[model samples]
Target chain A: MSNQILIPKLAIVGVGLIGGSLALALKAAGVVGEVVGIGRGLANLEKALELGVVDRITQDPAEGVADADLVLLATPVLTLTEMASRVLPHMKPGAVLTDGGSVKGSVARAIEPLVPEGVHFVPGHPIAGTEKSGAEAAFATLYHRRRCILTPTAQTDPEALRLVRRVWETAGCEVVEMDVEKHDRILGAISHLPHMVAYSLVNAVSSYDRYEENILEYSAGGFRDFTRIASSDPTMWRDIALTNRDALLEMIERFELSLAELKEDIRGEKKDRLYDFFLRSKQSRDAIL
Target chain B: MSNQILIPKLAIVGVGLIGGSLALALKAAGVVGEVVGIGRGLANLEKALELGVVDRITQDPAEGVADADLVLLATPVLTLTEMASRVLPHMKPGAVLTDGGSVKGSVARAIEPLVPEGVHFVPGHPIAGTEKSGAEAAFATLYHRRRCILTPTAQTDPEALRLVRRVWETAGCEVVEMDVEKHDRILGAISHLPHMVAYSLVNAVSSYDRYEENILEYSAGGFRDFTRIASSDPTMWRDIALTNRDALLEMIERFELSLAELKEDIRGEKKDRLYDFFLRSKQSRDAIL
Candidate 1:
């Protein structure tokens, strides 16, 4: 409790994996006094409550955030604006409001205008996750040793940004601040584009399942590693693909160009070029690993 | 040693990860009386001898294969034909020869003609590996619970095929036989295409490294998993690509078409189509997981 960020009441809209994990981490750290889980699904809310992810569960957003000191919207990027509008007016004045959406620019732009005069809106993205989803998959250490990106604009209040940063830091995140546009572009290259490629690769291999043998059945360590991200939530990825369409499209184009080069080298039997392509990629990936 | 397939002497050429692991496994199982390690690199061969993966080390293919009961050519696919030609004449009349190349169709076609009149040749691929290479990365348990595909033709001796299957089975592999052409096509869809996608992904993300921030520095679990196979041996992958060019090219084309559909759905903001695209891929990947 010595280094905890004090929040008398915390309200989390869309208390699934991200929200449930935040609630559990804060409670385990003895920071927040009480957490209210809000979502459209009653079954998920009940499960969150039973798992000690939240102190209370509510279907109504207004009732959930009525007296809350801090509010977090941890839903799909497309749904954030609607959810924020529902909870912002009911939140206590001088309270800090934040989000855990993957795409920051559009979500921040859409939700920034709807924020009340007194309540502060700070946009954030935690670069940590598995290919799993739902409240049952939530864990207290999901944020440990991970990076949490916060995109704040000129309109963002200093105290509110500090509080949001403290919360993420308390949950075991190394917090970093960056421009929303840069965040979107970088994430598009690293995260969104990979998801698209993984999904496409899986579909491509499964297309051959109509033959006598299921190609997927012969998948070894390499194919399984590639398919791990392909098994992520469909709705979540669909929303991501739409919200960050422009940046994601640019990244997909770049990736296709890179892939095309290798394809041509393979087709032409250019062993030297193929070796260089693979060697360069290995060097790049090893630098990061 | 009762259940072991005993060989008076086993000669392994190109004793890197695959070759070294086979030697170590057979030695540990007490199936072979002696193992001679032959390779282009003296350092690696000495390491293999030091690690007890082989009882003898030699740079001469003829000296290594002289009087051997079995010979395993475990080099890259492209080099298999030349290596086979080098050792085939020196191998004993009743000796069985096999290979551990990823691509089978072209390699089998190219090497089968060079086989000596009295010796047997069986093309094989073990569906197992780490992103590591060299004799130092070899281990006895590398083939445990893994699938090893053997492609034997009309000209192959049944006794030779049985001996090769027993060797892999003793190394804890589930042996399956298939046509060389079918093996290449299926491995093209499963392994080769995935490696291409992963290497391209790593290259695309690293393209941003020319900028201020290294995008790869922020790679999380998903990106790391996707890059695991990208870090595999460049020479080995290059050989596989050139040797299996036609099937790999076809698979890449199919993957591009599949990716294009997802790109269009995202570009047009077709939410339902995007959802269905992801949903289908998720279901396919999840089925195998």
Candidate 2:
């Protein structure tokens, strides 16, 4: 507590919004020293350095995470395991490794085995982000007041778990622990399903074939705001869809059943039923927001 | 251009967010000498008066529209015809009668016949509003830089059309004239369909039956913003669903088809197809926004 930094050398791979923001947040909290930004995109890594998001930048995975106290993989979910395999061999024995992907169970199952003898793997998801990408979208307050779920198994070391929790808490997140499977299911219902719906809805309007070009222009604020999530990174969401396929498929089926019932209510001109249907959704949404 | 007001007296039935906002905008523009708020809810009517959204309040349709230079029916789409019938007899000769309902073809078909010999009917829809309702949600800038579409048929008076266009322009709307059926079709594709999708999606998440109580709490900003439209007034949306039934049903069918394709793509892990699907929507949305 006297003058020692919590993380003497922290490595952040991927260095986009989530990774860059975490480095900025940890630096702002003064809990991390010698932050290193690593990514395939040299431009983004350089920008992160130029913007003071990191103390150094690197394109090589081994060069980035070697000798670091903590190495965080913040790439798209599907790439996390491969990136881990590349960097784990070179990381220090006691260094803690984690990620900020939306899907957790698959990541935990795939990467837990790749952890070196003395290294620790803690799969985490910071329940935050905008429909934005790149280092320019990064900000120190991106994770403030947001929830961060860490999925730790029996193999997770207690010290590594505490350190990971401290890192997120210092970045202003309310960190919670849960089993990885339950995290995927809950996130599948809330986050994955909604993104699918938005994506599908926008695609629907675009391909309506009635009057294609100008239909979206007539969209009011409701439509514009509703479809904002569809603008998120395609590769990231596609990976989430693939990684959490079972849970997402289940959620999609449930949603289709609900939509079918409401469609029938509208088609039959069941005024009372329609009113009750909308009233229930309104009440439910109102309770949430 | 003299010191005379554009509309000596204006009567707005169903004084909710839309009607109240119009009144406030016109009053702020100093174009209406007096505004009358009429609705079944006396509390909202009084709130409109207190907020200076209107100069007077009335429950009786006859007393509200009598001797007014302009009468605007801003109620739900389904109730516009019945309201028009109730107030048609009391409106002074040469007075303009318009509405702020979302659907226009059905309203025009039903209400145009009820217009008194000397009265003029112009069906207008200002493409603006928020999820909030009632007079308290009214604001003068609600319509600024928004679009207002007036569907005027052959029976519509030239003077009445001019006056309605002027009123919307004064409220900072870019007024456009279109056929009633085309307006309904365009709005059905954009506004009504999106509302229905949001309503159905919220219902879907609430009824998932997996982890009902805590699922929504885990929702990130994307899910919350995506479902915000579901919190709109149920009765108003119900009326919209019923009145714009055909076009909305068609749009729903198209949406279901689009969703089914995306669902299949996810289930099969068609990475290229999924990426392309999302890319298409993102490009379409980016173009619009």
Backbone Cα, N, C clashes tallied per candidate: 0, 0
Q: lDDT tens digits, residues A137-199, model 2?
A: 999999998999999999999999999999999999999898999899989988999899889
Kindly list the per-residue Cα lDDT of model 2 for residues B227-287, writing each as its tens digit: 9989999999999999999999998998899989999999999999999999999988887
- TM-score of model 2 vs. true structure: 0.98
Docking class of 2: high
In model 2, residue pairs whose N, Cα or C atoms come closer than 3 Å (at least 3 residues apart or on different chains), thus clashing, are none
The DockQ scores of all candidates, in the order shown, are 0.85, 0.84
Name model 2 segments beyond 4 Å from true.
A1-4, B1-4
lDDT of 1 at A274: 90
